[model samples]
Target: MGNLLGNWRFKEPSTVEECDSTWGSDSESDEPAAEDDSGISESVSPAESEWPPGNNGDLSPKLTDSPEFLPKMKRSFYAARDLYKYRHCYPNYKKSRQPNEYRNLRFYLNKIPLVPDGIYIEEILTRWRGDYDKLEHNHTYIQWLFPLREQGLNFYAHELTQDEIKEFQSTREAKRRFLAAYSLMLDFYGIKLLDKSGNVARSSKWQERFHHLNESQHNYLRITRILKSLGELGYEAFKAPLVRLFLEESLHRNTLPNMQHSILEYFVYTIRRPAARRHLLRYARQHYKPAHAFLWGPPPKRSKPKSGDVGASVGAGSSGIRAPAPTPEPQRRGGETSFIPASGCSGTLVSYHDATVCQDVDAESLNAYTPLGSSMDGPEGVFMMILERNNYSGAVPL
Candidate 1:
């Protein structure tokens, strides 16, 4: 192990006092390992205790343990440490000897060239819990493999080797296991993984219909079509910083949906709770910017043509915010009209008139869905009826 400790030098000094003073300082040992009560062997390899004790009774200030030493060492040399000493002598590697904070795992992992090379066991052992179960699950695969789908692997071909992909595939049995491993981090938050395998299957079965798209269109389809069509499943909304991180990281144009879903699952696994649906809706409205013509409801009624408001619809003010207009009278179909200001396109057609007289409102009169009339006490007043056929071929009345 010591030999395998590659060229990993302690970025900071390590000391006897630091190693000896702390029990379980060795990340590998929390409880007694296979070794009996002698604690770890006093064999004391150079890697374990090279630093001399100081005159101050503590180890020399220059020899204080590195902050990231344990993680770096654990990740790199753990498997072959005693098995093969030369494994630790890699080029360009630095050994951290101090107390490592969780946030520094990336800093260390970023330096390692091999996949599944090191396990941040100490960090995982301590912080790994139900509250952070999602993260743990996500890192399970990431611990042993890369976090990517087949398409993502293809997209980032240069980053991983074929052997690495094989290693990743071998680590998990089911799709969920693979998903859960990468999903744990995001699940910590309130994001749930939405399985759209059926949709994928359906699309596969009918591949010819979608084959006409060019590569860019295919890329877009790879993301938006399957992912978004799952409706709310594809989205992940969390607290501010995480949300911002996801939007910036996962929502880029080149990002494929499969990748988006994985990254989103990773983030969702991290979220503590699914934020209020309305909160998500608010973000959608602000970000999606759906156009008025694309909206399903009737076009906004013509306003009185207020000054400075130029072709502004009745619902929209100069500020461009769509204000809620008063309820519009129901469509009068065949029967006597009962004036009810319908809140939406569909409403209960309650009438004070007798049930027989309350047959369907006249279809012609239904077109006069006036938004303004006050009451329906007499014949002059409006009657309410839902339009059975939404196909109104005639021009929209102002």
Candidate 2:
């Protein structure tokens, strides 16, 4: 079987010359295949390949061939950088940074630019003041003025004349808007309405207006706001007027409690002088009921029990016979006198009639006494102490 297979067949290997010829034909076909794989290789010239050639051996294309290419690249790079910088500046940039709607003319003014001119100011005032005859003209003026004012042109307020000021102040609407417009300017120019005596004329005007208004027609709330503003603006002249208002006989007591309270608050919290504070405390104690004494501060502290008294009380309690109740002290006419144990040996006794009077006395000296409770009597002692400490001796009449 082996002899038959050998005779039947395996061909001999090709010679080296034949092999070389065959490989040479295959290589010729492979050259075209390789060129097809890289289509741009044949299209690119040696001069183009040598482009941008330097000691650095940069392989990038020469942009100089196309004159517009470098400029366009530079522009694109700078534009991208600028865009990045702008985005970085406002990371959460949005169109709705400020509110569109305003609650009042004052708020609107704050949001707007300052446009200072007489015509523009009058036009704005007329619009807010609801002048129907000049409505159209005012509207047009406002539209133009709004943008300018938003740009911070405040010349309009300075351009106002005394007559214009008086006209504006004649109506509440115009007055409000005008005041809002010039509030900052008033501070800037140190503009104060003063008389020949250097007292604030506005305060006198307000006081006169207050007296003229009937109880039913009185705008206490508005008056209070104005007074508060004046006080905040360092107008000391108004304080006396406020005190007079508090004591006004024509004013309704029931209706004026809130106003009175506000006045007292100003006196108590705002006034720094010892005389002013003493006056306020005296007035409040004389006027305000004992129930309302908490407006000042906590009640006065009670005296602690003595060690000997505690032992005596305990011994009395241990006995079967109950201790007799102490006799009630005699009541004084018009008011009452009560004793309060204050400190060691000495106790404080207060008398209340039209006003309060306090005297420190030895507890052993009194014939009969009663411990003071949480009634109005406590504040009397506190007020008397305050008055005495401040050397205020003038008696307050009922």
In model 1, what is the error at residue 318, expressed in angstroms? 28
- TM-score of every candidate relative to the true structure: 0.19, 0.24
Per-residue C-alpha lDDT of model 2 across residues 208-303, encoded as one tens digit per residue: 333332221112222332332232223434444344435332223432332343343332322222244344444554555323222332223235
lDDT digits (tens) for residues 1-398 of candidate 1: 87766645433113321211112122222332221100001111121111122464422112223332211111101111211111112222232343433221231233232233244433433344234323322322232222211112122111222233344334333223323432333333223334533211112212322222111111221222122211111222213333343343333432221223222222221222223212322232333212321111112345377678865444411211233211111211122233322334332222111011122346564554443333333221222222222322221000
lDDT of each: 0.25, 0.27
Worst 10 residues of 2 by lDDT: 36-45
Error of 2 at 252 (Å): 10
lDDT score, candidate 2, position 41: 6
Indicate the residue-level lDDT of 109 in model 1. Answer: 37
Q: What's the residue-level lDDT of 160 in candidate 2?
A: 24
